[model samples]
Target: MTSRLKRTLLALSLAISLPAGAANYSIGTGSQSGTYYPLGGMLAKVWSDNIENFNMRAEVTAASVENIIKVSSGQQLVGIAMGDSVASAIQGQAPFRKPLDVAVLFALYPNVVQFIVPADSSINTIADLKGKKISVGAPGSGTRVGSTAILEALGIHQGDFKAQSLNYTATTNALANGQIDAGVIIGSAGVGAITELALTRDIRILSFSQAELAKVHAALPAYSGMEIPAETYSKVTAFTAPAVWNVLVVKKDLDPALATQMLETAFGNMDKISKVIADAKNATVDNMDKLQGVPLHASSQAFLTKMKGQ
Candidate 1:
């Protein structure tokens, strides 16, 4: 063959052997402006940079439920799930029609359920929220599910309160503007949105007593035991509230090697990620095995095993 033709043929063969963009995998995150989306974007950037031949991307999904479904179907490679919700998704529990093959990449930080009442409001407890206007978080969010569950545990139904399906920003605004009596938020202990609201306006966290947690935990085994430490939020100087875990989930059948790399990347970058979100500072190798109810994927388990050994 002519020298030019031989060179052209060789280039074509090399190109054909290459797989798709190594740094181009999609992560299904939550609402456009929420923690999950930005967090996912951050992970995509970090992991894409750290891992070789595998880039990452992010998609705004309907938080937990939709993300799990999409991940299970392989529509999205990664998802951020509330621990309880992830467990339910794996077990095919409520809100999910059937059992799904969801696996944990690794555990993220806590998604604390904060019950907020006006600073001067008399609604100090969950029971007091009855007949009060409340923002129970955005539609299809983990907050919504947890709020609904919390209300149920407190023997308070949706109808009992003026349920507003608003996002954290909206909820903070609505509460500040007196549009709602209480706002139920599911986020990190040091959530930016929550802190911003607390700066000027005095707020107190509605502490969940043991009985309340008992009922909630009974129905949701996936929830991890948590406490909002004293001074964690200025709004609650010494608040002690129950919290839940968050999980990095994936399709059960995703390539194990890819999953391992992702999990390692997540935990390895724990400090950097924690800076992106307040609760994440606590994310470490120690927490990788603590998904509560959601089971870890084989690849993730293998990584955790190595992490533990090290």
Candidate 2:
């Protein structure tokens, strides 16, 4: 081949072999059986497809607390976390040695605190959980943080109950096998684990009384009253529960332009994301107000403002 022809061939080969300006990132998600994992996967796919040279992956993590620490410490690019945990981290709470610098990308959905028990069990109220074997979710998980806070608000300290930290799948299995009296699952309605558990065995979701809810709200102001609608799970009736919004977060210092691009890619593809996770339909510019405590990432705030004006 002529020298000019050879040079042209080499250029073509380089173009095919190297991805110019490629950017790789991972989204820290929760357990495989939980909502965060699937939702994170969907977001990664959509963002990857829409953003030029952007490759994103979903990583299974210990959920909220771990996600926050990882993202804030620059170990991960982004993560999904509970609003309460984000607030706690900002305030330098336990599990967080000191305040973390993080910013909200957007609100995902409300993670309702589901206190699940066997349908026939007599444990109808939060007060009845005293001294019972309970699964308070996995270590460093949002479920654990919310459960511990709710229980403490009700005057049920650590010693008042037998606490077991287990993942959603293990919690369901243990409950099914009569190993634990109840399990605390904090996720969007129709969480996969709870749905699967309800398929084989009848289960009841205990509700918080008005008085109990007041105490909980007083303690954890980030939480608000929410009702898990009737039949959200098989044979489980609607019940009042405390819920906190789940949010996508990124490091505070992420590039404003890149952050805006990420938000645009995700928001523009909401239809696709909602098809995969029904709760994702709630992730809209209007619902940005649902995010509590943490400030919105500058790019996200600008994006929302732009979306609103349009």
Candidate 3:
């Protein structure tokens, strides 16, 4: 064949083999040690593998607040955010300048609030945290937002305690080194940081009193009381704590059809995801009821309606 014809043939072959208009997307997740990160990675893999001409990756982020901002700005295609953060953002609450255009794809799982302190510490209850140094997660993390709300609801205002904004790993380290008196972590039941800390040092998971939980619920209706099963972490017993369901969200302008495809792909592969992230087992069509306050993506509403019918 002529050299020019050979080049033409090569170009045509490449076109035939590669997907037309292939697109790359990213899912914004939390710290490397958090549940969101691994869940995001699993999603990226399954979505990329199942979707034609689409590539997806999981980006490590500061979690909910940052994820919401980045997803709204189109920096990331999707994000996992706590329901409380989503509600606050939608209402143009603090840390967000104005209501952002974001919609939920589906509910993931409940992020249980875990109050960690040295096992033998004198801090016995939420009220005892007064005047104590506490790590309430990173500045842009949902843990920070939710923990603050919880503390304030119980009359433990910022000035009432020395509040520190640190990520999960940092919070764990600070606790181990006696840098903080207590740390508030809102994550999946088997959160790596808390689990690792429990293994190396004796730690306690504090529970809320009925009145305290009632106060929190009255102040922030988005939070619900839940239990962290015994043995979920070593050296810890079952305890009741506040929890907020985590939701997968996409930007408002994302294509409806694409959103539908993504949801279908994820729900269809729940078995595979659950194998990797135990919390994923709770990510089901039935749990769609858990997602509240946030507007559902048009595609998600339709898809969920169709699934519930079947």
Model 1 lDDT tens row, 1-310: 8999999999999777655665457888886646788888888988888888776788887688778888888788888878777777767777788999888877777788888876788987778888988888777678888778877766898778788899888888888998889897887777778788888788888887777777777766655446677667674755556678877888778788877777777777878877866666656778876766567788877877876798
Worst 10 residues of 3 by lDDT: 286-295
lDDT rank order:
2, 3, 1
- Tell me the TM-score of each prediction against the true structure: 0.86, 0.93, 0.93
Clashes of each: 6, 0, 0
Tens digit of per-residue lDDT, candidate 3, span 10-85: 9999778667798888999999999999999999999999999898899999999999999999999999999999
Tell me the tens digit of each residue's lDDT in model 2 across 170-264.
Answer: 99999999999999999989999999999999999999988988898999998888977899888889999999999998888899988988888
Question: How many clashing pairs in candidate 3?
Answer: 0
Position 99, candidate 3: lDDT: 94
Misplaced by over 4 Å in model 1 are: 1-20, 32-34
Name the regions of candidate 2 deviating beyond 4 angstroms. Answer: 1-18
